[model samples]
Target chain A: MSFNVIGKSVIRVDGLAKVTGKAVYPQDIYMDGMLYGKTLRSTVPHAYFTLDTSKAEKIEGVVRIFTAKDVPGHNAHGVLFKDHEVFCAQKVRRIGDPLAFVVATSEKIAQKAVEAIEVKYEELPAVFDPVEAMKDEIKVHDGTSNIIYHYKLRKGNIEEGFAKSHVVVENVYKTSMVDHAFLQPEAGIAYVEEDGTIVVCAATQYPHFDQLEIAEAMGVPAEKVKVINPAVGGAFGGREDITLQIHLAIAAVATGGPVKAVYSREESFVAHSKRHPEIIKIKTGADKEGKLLALEAEIIADTGAYASWAINVTRKSGIHVTGPYVIPNVKVDAYAVYTNNPFCGAMRGFGATQVPIATEQQMDMLAEKLGISPVEIRLKNAFTKGSETANGQILTESVPLITCIKKVADALEMA
Target chain B: MKKRGKGIACIFYGTGYGNGFPDVSRAYAELQPDGKVAIYTGATEVGQGAKTALSQIPAEVLGLTVDDIIFINEDTSITPDAGTAAATRQTYNTGNAIKMAAEELKKELINIAVKELGLNSDAGLEMKDGKIYLKILPDKCITLAQIAAKQSEPLRTFATFTAQTVQIDPETGQGAPYWPYTFSACAVEVEVDTETGQVEIIKAAHAQDVGRAINPKMIEGQMEGGFAMAMGYVLYEDLGLENGRIWNNKLSTYIIPTAMDMPEIQNIIVEDPESTAPYGAKGIGEPVMIPVGPAILNAIYDAVGVRMTEIPVTPMKLLQAIREKEKQGA
Candidate 1:
C-alpha cells in the first residue's frame, strides 16, 4: 500500500503530551490511601546474615514489613540461573541486597523505619576480581564455587592455526561495569484487589516477564498479575529485569493495600543490574597474505553476586571474540565468574562490545606486521556466506558483515 | 590516501528481537459516525513515531488523508497487541496489521457503495478518502460516510500478524534470527593533535541497507542519535567503579556526548525492499550505534599511527600512545 504518513517524519504522538508534563509515569500515579514503600539494604559487601524486622515493624506509621520469609513463592528470579534472592534471608551477598521491605504512611516515615531494621552478619573477605573471584573460599552464593557459567567456541585446531600464521598478536583488554542509567528511576505502584489480582504499573522494559515474576513473588496466578509499562525515560536494556514490580507486589500483598515504591538515584545505582565487566585476552593469527587463520581467547566476566544472564553474556563474548570474520580455527574460553562487585546483566552490545576492543585491535596489530592497512586485512577476512564461525556454525543467512565492512570502508574511502 | 581521510564502517545488528517469543500483533481501524477515520494500534511510541507510522499505513491502505486518521495507541483496552515498539519493528510488523484493517474497510465500503448505487456490479472501484470512486468512469463517487450511513453498518475491522523471526540455535548462535536484516555501515574521519593527542571526528557517514526508507528524516534522526551515543562510547562515556560501587554515579563524573560533539552525519538509507515488510522496510535503530565505535577507533589509528585497543580514546590514552612514539623516536 502507498503510504502518505508511513514514510514521513511526523511528530511523535506523545511529544506534546510529554512536553506539557501531562505524561503520567508510575511515580505520578497517586491513589487514595497509598502507602510509601522502601527497602532496607545491607551495608556489608558479603556475608551470611539474618535480618530481623521486628523493631522496624513497630515504628509509628509503619504499616507492615516483609523479609524473605514473607515471600510465599520461590525467593529467586534470574534470567538464566535463578540465584538472586528477592529479599535476603539467610545471607547478604552484595551491599545493595534488599533485606526488608517497609511500608509506612509517608516516604519520610518509611525511610525512618528502614533505619530501625536490624540485620546480623558474619563478615567475610570479599573477592571482586573476575579471575581471583573464581577461587574465593567465601562462597558469595550458596551452591557451586565462584565459577557460575563457562561458554566455549571450539572449531579447528588452534595450535595448528597459529602455526600456519605469519603474524600472531596477543593482547588483554578490560571494560568496567556499565549501568544502563536510564533517566527514569525505578518506580512502581502495586495493589492487590479484592479478587486477589495484583496490578503493578512500572517503568519497565519487559512487561510479560515482569508479569510472570510478579505473579510468582505475589503468590498468585500469572493471570492475576498485570504489569503496564509507563513512559520509561530510557531502558537501554536496564529495565529488562524486574526491579520494583515484584518488590511492590510483595509490599502490597504483605501490607494488604496499595503501595508505591520508588528507588532513589543512589538506590538505583546500587541495586540495579549493570553491564558485565569483562576481561578478555585476545590472540589473533593471520597468514602472510593477511588472510585470518585463528583467534583463541580467554574471557572472564564478573557476574557479580548473583547470576543475571551472565551465562548468555559469556556465550556471546565467546563467539564474537573472533569477531565478524572468517577463521578456519578459533577457540574462546568465556567464563562468568561470581564476584563481590555489582550485579551485571544486559547492555546495548550484549557482551560483544568488549571483545571487539581486543580482537579488532589485534587485527590492526596483525595488519601492521603484514604490511597492510587494518581495513585491508579485515576486508580480506570479513566473513561472507559459507564461512564457518568459531562455534562451527556456518553463515547461511545474511552474512552482511563483509558488506557492512565494505560500505564503511567505502564511505570513509579507507581503500 | 590523503592525510585528511574519509572511511566507511558497516554496522549491522539483527534488530528485531529473538524468535522464541510469541510474535503476536493486531491493529483495528474504524470510520466513526462523525466521518473521521480512527486507527487503533497497540504500538507504543517510545519517542520513535509508531503513532505516525500507524496513521500513515492506514491512510495509504484505505486511500485517506493522514490528517483524517485519528490514531489510538498503546492502550490494551482499546488497541490490540501490535507488539512492543522496540527493535524498529513498528514500521513493518505493525504496518502490515494496519494495512489489513484498512483493506477490510475499503472492501466493506466498496460493497456498500456497490449495493446502494447499483454501480455496474462492483467492478474496478477505488476507495479514496472515505469515498468510493469508479476506476473506469473516473468521476463516479460517493463518500464512505454516506454509504456507511445508508447501509446502517459500522465500518470497523481488525488485522493480526505473526511476523516470522526464526530463532538461532542456542549453542551455535547462528540462525536467520531476524525476519529481514537491516544493514548499516559508518565511516568516520578523525584528526588527532600530534602534540596533545586530542582527536576530533572530522566527518562521518552512515550507509544503511534499510530495506526501505520508511522515513528518511526519521532514519537521519536515528543516525544522528546513534552517532551521539557512539561519540560518547568513543571519546566520553565510562563507568568508573571503586571497590563495588560506581565512582561515576552522577553526570558530573559521567559524561555523554553533547551538542558540540556531533559531527556532520551523511545518512544514506538503501531500500532493496523485503517482500514481507510494509513497503520493504526493516528495523534500523541499534545498527547506528554498533559500528560507530569501531569506525572512530579505526580513524584514530589512521590519524595517529596508534591502534587504540580500548574505548573512550580519551586524551590520556592518546597522549600515552604519543609518548611511546616519542620513546621510539629517541
Candidate 2:
C-alpha cells in the first residue's frame, strides 16, 4: 500500500509530558478528601495468625480497619486458581501475605495505624524445595498434593537410542529466580463516588485484564469498575495477574471515601512476582559422529504457595529442551511443585529463556565429546524450514535460524 | 584487582497470537472553511512516535503536508480504543486505521462537491492541499471551503479493523500464530578477564526483520535501548531476595546497565513487510531484547572457551571456571 507514515519515525506521544515532569502518576492523583491505605504483612514466611483490627480502627484519624471479612464478594483473588487469600485469615503461607489493613486520613496516620495493629502467630514448618515438597509431607495449599501440574514429553525411542550411542552424559543444572522490577511500585487510587460507581486508577500493564478480575472480586459490574492506567514506568509481565487492584476496590467500597494505596520499593519486590527457579536434570546420548540420538530430561520448578504461571513456565522449558535443534529421540518430564518460596509468576523472556540456557550448555558439552566446534555442532542440528522441532510440528516459515547461528559464528570468527 | 572482558548475546521472540482482537482506531480529517485539515485518532502516544507516524498517515492520504495536519484523541471518552499501544502495533494497526478514515473523508467531500455543483462527473477528482480538483476540466474545480459551505452535510471519516493471529498448539508450542514473527539475531564480542572473571562487551551487530521501518530513527532507538536492557539482564540485573524478603529493593542495591557498560552496536534492518500489517509492520519493540542475552553468553564462550551457563555471569563464577580449567591442566 502507498503510505506516508506507517513506517516513518515520528516523535513520541509522551515525550514532552515525561521529560517536562508534567505527567501525572498515580501518586499525583491527589484529591481534597483522599485517605491512605496500608496493609499489615506477616514477618515470618509461614505461620498461623489471628489479627485484631479494632485497635488500628480506634486510632485518631483512622478510618475503617478491615480484614478478610470486609471483602464483600470473593475474599481471595488469583488468576489460575482460587488458592491465595486476599487477606490472611488462617495461615500466612508466605512472608509478604497481607494479614490486615488500616485506612487513615493522612499517610503518616496510616503508617502509624499499621504499627498499632497486632497479630499473634505460631511459626510452622516451611518448605522451600520442590523436590522435598513433592513428597507431600507438608502441603502449601490445603488438601491437594504439593504438585500443581506435571507434564511429560515422549518421542522417538529413548532406551534403544541410548544403548546404540557411543557416549552418554548426565548432569543437573539450576536457574535462579529473577525479578521484573518496574520503576513504579504498586500504587492505585480508588473511591466509591456519590453515584456509587467505583473508579480505580493506577499505573499498570494489562489494564483490561485487571479490570475484569477486580470486578469479580468486588461483586461489582465490570462497567461500574473503571480501571484507568496512568503512565507506566515498566512491566516485564510482572502485572499480568491481579495484585493490589482487588484490595484497593475493597478498601474503597468499605471506606466510602477516596482511598489510595502504594507499595514501597521493599513491599513491591516482596509482594510482586518473580521468575521460577528450575532444577533441570538431563541424560543425553550421542554417536561417535556427534549425531545426537536421545535426550532424557526431568525438570522441577518451585511454584511457591500458589500456581501462578509456574506450570506454564515449566511446560515452556520442556518444549524447548533441545533448543533450536533437531533431536530424534526426546523425553522430558516437568513438575511444578508448590513450595513456601516467594510466589513466582511471569517475567520477561517468558518460558523459552530458561530452556535456551540449559540446552545451549548441553550443545557445548556434546561438541566437546565429539571433538568438534560448538558452532559446528549447532549448525549440524539447527532446525531449518521444513525441519520439524522436537515436538514434530512443521516450521512453515522462518528458516533464518541457521543463518542466525551462522551470523554469530562468522562474527565471532569461530574456526 | 578486577579486569573486565567483553560479552555478547542474541535472541528474538514470537509475535502475538492472531485470535483477532478488535483493533478499532478512528482518525477524522475535517477540512476547514479556510485551507486547513485537522486529524483526530484515539491512538495514545506513550513515548514511541505514535503521533508522528499517525499524523503522517493522514497527511499522506489527504495529499497534504505533515505540518498542515493535527492528530487528536488520547482520551478514551472521546476516541475509539486502539488496543493498548504495545508490541509496537500502534504504527502498523492505528496508522492503517487513520488512512482509512482520511480516504472516507475524501470520498464524502467529492460527493458533496458533485451534489452542490449538480455535476455527474465520476471521471476525475483527487484531494490536494485544501482543494478538490477535476482532472478532466482545467477550471471545473472548487476549494474545500467553497464545497463545504455549499453542502448541508459535514465531511468526516471512520475506520475499524481487527488484527488477527493464531495460537500455537499448547502441546507443541509451534504455530505461525503471527502473520510473521519479528525476527532479530545478534552477534556480540566480549573480553573476559582470566583473574577476576569480569566481562566487557566490545563490539556488537544486531540484524532484525523490522517488517518495514515505520520510523528509521525510532527503530534505531528501540534497537539501542533493547541492547542496553539485554546487557543488563546478562551481566548486572538480579532480584536479590532472601527468604521471600527483598534484600536489594532500592536502586543502590539493584544494578542496571549504565552508559559505561555499553558496547559498540551496529543495527541492521531486514525488511520483510507483513502482508496483513499497516505498511507491512510487525511489532519491533519486545523482540529486540529477547534474543540479546543468549547472544552475549554465546560470545563469552567464544572469548574464554568457558560456559558461564547461568545469568548475571558474575566474576566469582568466572573465577571458579578459570580455576577449574587450570586444575584440569595440572
Candidate 3:
C-alpha cells in the first residue's frame, strides 16, 4: 500500500532544535547550589583497601565525602545480579571499583578532593582468564562460583549423526572485549524538589527502569523518584546499566541540595559495561553431499567481575551458535564466567556479534574442505519455511536467505 | 602487492521482545475547538523521526494535513505509557495505536457533521482535506472548524494496541520468538595490501527487505550509519583492554574510522509488506548492521587466501596470516 508519509523521507522532528542549539541534554542542566560530584576509584585491581578521607574532608570547597557506610539503603545494585557495590567498603575487585565519593562546590575542587583521598591496599591473587575462572577455584564473587550463568541447547542424537559424516572440522575462535564508544560520556543531574521528590535528569536509554532502580537504592517510594531523560548523545547499550544515577541521587538527598555528576572519558570506560570477550570451540561434521550432519560448540564468555546482562547474553549466544543454517543434530554449551576484569554486559549486538564471526568462518572452512564454492555450500543448507533450527524454532515467514544469496551473487557478478 | 575480491553475507533479525514480554502501546487523539488535532503518547524520539512518522498516521487516517496536527510526546506525567522506544517499535506499535485513536475521533466528528448538516445517512458523509462532504451531492459540505464551533460535546479518543507474541520454550529455545522478522543482505569489495596488511573496503552494496519502508530516506540514513559502525567493528574498532584496565582510554588512542576511511555505499530497499505491521512495515534498525561485518571478513578471505577468524581484523594479524601462508607455500 502506498502511503503519503510512511515511505517518504521526512526530516527528523527535532533536527532543527538539535542543530540550532535549542535542544537541552543532561549535561546542559544546571541548578543553583548544585555540588559537583566525583568518585575515587581503586588503583589496584584486587585488594582490601582502607580509604583515608581525613585530609580530603579538610579541603576548602569540599561539601561532604561519602563511603559505603553512608549508604542508608542497600549498597549494592546490578541489572541481572545485584553483586556490584555502589561504594567499596573494604575490598576492591576491579580497577574501576569506587572507594569513596566526594561532593564539592566545583568540579575542580571535587577533583582535588579525590586526589587528596589516599587508599592503602593489600593485594590478592586474581584470575583474569575466563577458562581458568570457570574451574571453580578462584571465586570472583564471594560464595558463588566463578561461573555465573550456564546455558545449553541439545538437538537430535549427535553421536549417531556424526558417525554418518564423511568430513569433520574443528576450530577455536576468540573475540576481544569492546566498548560501546557512544559520543556521550555518562552525565547526569539530581536534586530533591520542594515536594520531597528526588528528580534525576540524565542521558539514558531507559528512564522508567532508572527511576525504579534509583528509588529502590534510595529506600524511597517509586513515586518519590522521577527520572527524566534528555537528548541522549548515544546509548548503544552502555547507558542501559546504572552509571551515575544512584550516586547522584545519594549526593542530592544526603546534602539536601542539587548535585551533578559527569563521568570523564576515562571514568566512562571503566564505569560502564563492556562487550564480553569470548572463546568459542566449535566442531562441524558434514556428509559427502555437503549437508551438515552434526555440530557441537562450547562457548565461554568473560562476563568480568559482575553479572549485568550476562545471563541473557550467554543464552542469546547459545541460541545463535547454529547461525542461519539448518542443523538437525547439535549440542551447545555457553557460559558467562566471572573474572577480576572490567565487567561486561550489553553492547550494540550483545552476544549476537561474537558468535557469527566464528560460525561464518566455520562455514567457509567447511565449504573449502568439501571442495564446493562458498555460495553453493550455503545455498545447500540455507533455511526455508517449515525448517527447524538446532534450537527447535520453526521458520514460518520472512525466510529469505536463498533470495538474498541469489541477489548478492548477481550483484557481485555484475560488478 | 594488493589484490581485490568480493563476498556476501545475509542476516535475519527478530523485532521487539517476543519472548512473552507483554508489549503494549497507548495513544490519545483529541480534535480541538480550533480544528487542530493533538496526539499524546510516551514515545521518545531518539533522533529517529518518530514524531514525523507518528503524525503521518493520524493525518492519513483523519484526512487532515500533517501541519494541522500537534504532537505532545515523551512526557510521562502527561502522555500514556506507549512502551520504550527501542526495538524499532515506535513506528509499528505506536503508529497503529495512533491510527486507531484518530479513526475513533474522526468517527465522532463525522457523526456530528451528519447531525448538523441534516445528512440522509452517515455513509454519504466523508472527511477529506479538513472538510466533511456528502459524496452524492459533492458540494454540500461543512468545514471541521464549523463542526468544532457547533460542538455540543467533546471530540476525543484513547486507544491501545498490544502485540501478540509467542513465548519460546526455555529448555529447547523453540517457538516463535517475535511476531515478524526483518531480512538483509550485504556484499562488500575489499582491496588487501599484502605487504602492509591493510584491507581497504573499496565499496559496499546493502539490500534490506524492510517489509515496507516507513521512510525511505530515513532507512537510507540508518543503512549508512549502521554500515559505517559495522566497518569499524570488522576492521578498526577494538576496546583494547590490558590486565582488566583500558589501554586506549582516549579517542586519539582508540581509533575509529573517520570520513576518509569510509567506502562508497549503495543501498537497495525491498518492499514485501508485512500483513500484521503498521503500513506493512518491519524494523530495519538492527537488521541492517548484522550482515556487514561477516561480509567484510569474507571479502578479506576472498582477496587473500587466508581466513582471519577474530574481529577487528588488525593489520598485524593480517600480515602474520600472509607470512604463515607464504612459509607454507615455500
Candidate 4:
C-alpha cells in the first residue's frame, strides 16, 4: 500500500522540455536537402479515374511524381484491413483519396506540382447513410456487400424473459461523427540511413506498427524501416492509423533523400478518420422490483470509405450494449456498414461511448415507471461480485460499480 | 426562467485489446556503468503522461528516484515493441513489462552484492537510494555502482507481458473477452433556460475505481479533460458533414469547449486495485470520458421534462423539443 514511487505525483518526466518550448515536434525537425512532399487528392467521392502525371513531371522543381503504377509493393495499408489504397489507381471511394504524390525541392513547388497533375473521372452514385447502405443496392467496394461487418449476441431467451418483465422501455438514440482535434496537424520526415534503413520521424500512437506498415508498402523487410515518434502534439485516436508516415517513406526511398510533409488543418480534417456515428435502437425490460430482466438492441455504425477499426468498434458496442447492469436475457445485433462518408475508426471511448445515452435514459425511464428513484433502480441491478454479464462472463474481482455510484451520489448530495 | 436538476450515470469498461487479441508489451532495462538505469520501450506518449508513469515503475522496482532513470521510448529500432498506446493498455501492459525487467536486474545486483560481501546466504537484502543494505544492520551496505564494477558482464534484462483473454464464441458471443474491467460513475447538476433552451452545467462530480492511482494528479487531469471532451460531444462539437465533405473543417467554425465553459468539478478517486497489474494500477485514460455524456444528458432531462435523442443537443433542437412538449401539454 505505502511505497516510494508507485502512488506519488511525480512531475511528468518530459514536462521541462515541453514547457520551455524545447520539445522538438515532427514539424520542428528539419533535415538537409529534405524535399517537400505533397499528395494530390481526389475531389470526387466515388469515381473511376485516369491520372495524367505528364504535366506534373514537367514542373520546374519537381523531382518525382508517384502514381499508383509506380508503387513497388502492395499499394494498400490499413490498421485492420488492407482496403485503403495508398493512391487511388482506378477507382476512388472518398473525396480525400490520394491520386498522386509529388516530391519537389520546396513546399511551394510540391503544391504546384500536385496542382499540375490531372485526374479525369466518371462519378458514380454513392450511399452516405449506413442504414441505406445496408440494403446492398449500392456497393462502396466493387465485389463486396455494403455491410462491412456484423456481430450478433444471443443469451438465454429474449422472448420469455421479456414476457415475464413488468415494464419495457424502448427508444432510439443517435450520436454524431466527431474528430479528435488534437491541435497539431499531421507531420513527418523520412530518409534513408547509411545502412540502407529508412528512418521515419513523426507524431504517431504506434511507431513499431508504422515501421511494419511502411516496410510492407515499400517492398522491404520490417527491419529496413525505423520509426521514431517526436514530441507528439496530441492523438486521441486519430493517429492510430497511417497518415503521412508511409507517404514520406515512399518519397524518401524514391528520392534517396529526406522527404517531409505537413498537413494543413483542413487537410488533416479531410484525411484522417473520425469517430463512428451510431444509430442505436434499444429496448430494456425490468421486473417490478427494479431488477433488469431482458435487453434487445440493434446498433448500426457508419464506417465510411474504408474499414479502419470498424470490426472491433462495432463488436465492442455489442459486447457493452447492456451497460454495467445485469441483464439475464440479451439479444443484440451490431453492424458496421460502409458508406461514402468520412471514414471512422477508434476514438477515446471506442464504441462504448454511444450506447450509454440510450441505456442510462432507459434506466431513468424504467425507474419513473416503477415509482422508484434512478439511483435506487441502478443500485438494484448493477453488477456486483460473481454477477454474470450478458456475455456470460463472471465478474470475479474489482467489481466496484456500486461503490462508484455511491461516491458520485454522495458528492452530488443525492445519496 | 431557469430550472435546475441533478442526474447520475455509471459505466464499466474493459481494459486492453480484448477478445483474444495478442495484447502484448515488451520492455528492456539496463544498468549503466554510472549506476543509473535506462528503460527502453516503444509506448508513445501522446501527452497522456505515459513516459512519467512508466518510468515510475522501473524506479520503484530498483529503489531509485524517477530522476535517476533515463527513459527512452517510441523508437522502433532502439526500443522493443510495447504495442499501441490505445485501448488504455500502456500503463497496465508496458508498466508491468518494465517492472519485470527491472525486477530481473534487481535480482542480479543482489547476487553480486552478496558475493562481494562474502555472505553465507542472500537474505534480508533491500535496495534503496542506490545502495544495497541488509534489513537489520544499517551499516552493512554497498553502492550499486560498486556492485556494477564487480560484474563481469553488463547487467541488462528484457521482459514481455501478455494479457490473458478468451475469444468470444461467434454464435453465442459468450466468453471472458476482457479481464479487470474498470468502473466509473458521474453526476451533474444543470440549469436549463426554459425559454431559450440553453443548458449550463452548474456542478459535476465524478468517481472512478482506478485500480490504483499511480499519479493522482494525472488521474485528475484525465478526469477533467474527459469531462471537457464529453461535454463537447454532448452539446457543442459537431462535424458538419454534407455529402462526405466536412464543411466546418476549421476550428473557428467547429466549436469545442473553452476553459470558461467548464463548471466546478469534483474528482473522487477510488482505489480498488487489480491484483495482476503493476503496483495494482489500471488505466484511467479512456474510462474517464465514458460516463460524462449520459450524465449530462440525464441532467438536461431532469432540468426540463424533455428527452432529446440526438447528440450535440444544440439550442435550436432543444428549443424545438421544448415547443413540441408545450404543444402536447396544451
Task: Pick the lDDT winner.
Answer: 4
What DockQ does each prediction reach against the true complex?
0.34, 0.29, 0.48, 0.86
Q: Which candidate number has the best DockQ?
A: 4
Q: In candidate 3, which residue ranges exceed 4 Å CA deviation?
A: B30-38, B64-73, B82-134, B137-162
Single-chain TM-score of chain A, each candidate: 0.94, 0.95, 0.97, 0.98
Sort by DockQ, top down from the best: 4, 3, 1, 2
* Deviating ranges (above 4 Å) for candidate 2: A158-171, A282-297, A326-328, A368-387, A402-415, B1-12, B17-180
Task: Give lDDT per model, in order.
Answer: 0.73, 0.70, 0.80, 0.90
Q: Kindly list the per-residue Cα lDDT of model 1 for residues A337-403, writing each as its tens digit.
A: 8888888887666675566667766777787788998678878877666665554545554455555
- TM-score of candidate 3's chain B against its reference? 0.93
> What digit string (tens of lDDT, one per residue) describes model 2 on residues A289-317?
77788888888888777777776566666
Error of 3 at A36 (Å): 1.4
Better of 1 and 2 by TM-score: 1
Task: Look at candidate 3 and tell me the lDDT of residue A218.
Answer: 86
Ranking by TM-score: 4, 3, 1, 2
* Candidate 4 residue-wise lDDT, B1-330, digit = tens: 898989999988888889999999999998877788999899999999999999999999999999989899968999999999898889999999999999999998888888777776678888999998888886778888887776687788999999988899888899987876889999999998988888899999999889889999999999999999999999988788889888889899888888998999999999988888998899988889989999998898888889878998988888899889989999
Where model 1 places Cα greater than 4 Å from the true spot, the runs are A1-3, A52-55, A135-138, A145-149, A154-161, A192-196, A253-257, A383-413, B1-9, B17-44, B64-123, B138-179, B191-199
- Per-residue lDDT of candidate 3, residues A271-337 (tens digit): 8998888899999888888899888999999998888889877876776778778888998889999
How many pairs of residues collide in each model?
A: 12, 25, 1, 0
Give each model a TM-score: 0.86, 0.84, 0.93, 0.98
- lDDT at position B43, candidate 3: 73
